[model samples]
Target: MDMWLHTANGQVNLRVSRQLYTVQSEYQTIEIFESPEYGRLLVLDGDVIFSRSDEFIYNEMVVHVPMAVHPHVKKVLIIGGGDGGVARELTAYADIEEIHIVEPDQVFVEACKTYFPETAQSFDDPRVQLIHRDGLRYLRGRQGEYDLIISDSTDPFGHTAGLFTKEFYGSCYRALREDGILVYQHGSPFFDEDETAFRSMHRKVYHSFPISRVYQAHIPTCPSGYWMFGFASKQYHPVTDCNPQRWQARNIKTWYYTTNLHRGAFMLPKYVEDLLKEAEAK
Candidate 1:
């Protein structure tokens, strides 16, 4: 018999085989399951955060796009990326000297370290610093410090909803250096509810940063399989400042992100374009 796990809204049922590990942390429920289709699966609060088979797509896009655009990114900060996938990608680059992660849940980190060793290996890097604290509060005093800040957080709900607020974005803006960039998971723009949140987030981030834009990535396991990421910068535009030659010189080979795709991701669909316009109107 096959096991099934329903994702957000319980609208889709993902097939599973054996339960590997389960933990009820103070923050949320974390589960690891072996799925024949997706390989190792990581679940938090009943939401499928990532499946090993396709995680490269989401993780690579989220990390590489902004990094490729920024000429020199040395200091990086990640908020709420408990799975360590984001940190794993950042550490792969030798140019990044320090990586500070502010994740509130230690249980989630241990769960990832135990079950998803490949992704969790990020913790082994000497450059990575994992801090157990709320990401919002962690950024309170750090101003003009990080060259890049990536919020690889959960969807906006429960305790994470604050991450989407104008106040949190303001903090992120202040935490970044003058030429630094901010990248984060901006939910999906395909559904009504998700699009509403996306538009609101874009509006709030726009107010905080001088330049901001939304980009797309395809994640088969996420809601609707079409995900969005936000790029906000004080000095660089995602496409204009992106140096394909410079990134290629680093010899970083990625599964989903390419310099060509980085240029193309910012091309929004009609509906998404209209949504941004509508948000601006309000």
Candidate 2:
């Protein structure tokens, strides 16, 4: 039931256990297999995307920070997060009117719904509208549409390769409203040294927006236990004035994100800052 998985850098390893499960309602799929280490790590057509377990940290950060910063966020668009973890966090906000989840693979969504109920429950919420199609194609057909666009995609490989392209970033810029914010999960900062993809995306997004910044988070499953998120906004920066007393009133117990943590996350290390500066100069 247990298997060892090696990291890309060959410096880290994980022992995963296999389990069995099923999802009964809506796009149901029968029992297949589950990875006990990181919850359901699925290998479909040689592409990997998490199907279950505690990887919500990445999704939560990508979804919550932009929502929290833009208090008036009424509409949200999530690209490629068929697992619904981002959608789950979006439902937590009472002000959100509609959440559009655009995922290309119906099977991935179905598998998640069946085997990983917690990650899939957000799809059941009335506020969520699931769209089965290519995310870039969908974005190309829309304009000035969303209040916030969260690109909850897999690593920049295979079908997800388009997500990091400048064309896609351009479309995302057009898809957002005037005051909209775009937050995308830019892969792990550890293994990715050149950061060419992130820099290219940042340059494209900076063309139309006044604010473009990158932040990092530590996730156990991701490479180097560190990941980065890029935020682009037409009218807002990720850092905003927060009413500490009001946030305290919400009474929510957060594992990783907080008012203090939010500010701290933006403070980048000297190395990363230097890299970004070099990229900007080029």
Best by TM-score: 1
lDDT of candidate 2 over 1-282, digit per residue (tens) = 566655454634556575354333332233434555566664433223443554667766887677667758899999988878888888887778999999977877877787768878998899999999889899996889999999988766667778878788888889999988999876655555536766665666666467888888887656566778888888877877434455556565566777777778889988778666766676
Superposition error at 35 for model 1 (Å): 1.5
TM-score of 1: 0.97
lDDT of 1 at 234: 93
Candidate 1 lDDT, 14-104, residue by residue in tens: 8999999888999998898988899999888888889999999988998899888998899999999888889899887998999999999
Consecutive 10-residue window with the lowest summed lDDT within model 1: 5-14
Q: Pick the candidate with the highest lDDT.
A: 1
**Candidate 2 residue runs with Cα over 4 Å from true position:** 7-12, 19-53, 192-194, 241-248
Provide the overall lDDT of each model, using Cα atoms, as 2-decimal numbers. 0.89, 0.74
Q: Per-residue lDDT for 5 in model 2?
A: 55
Per candidate, the number of residue pairs that clash is: 0, 1
Clashing pairs in 1: none
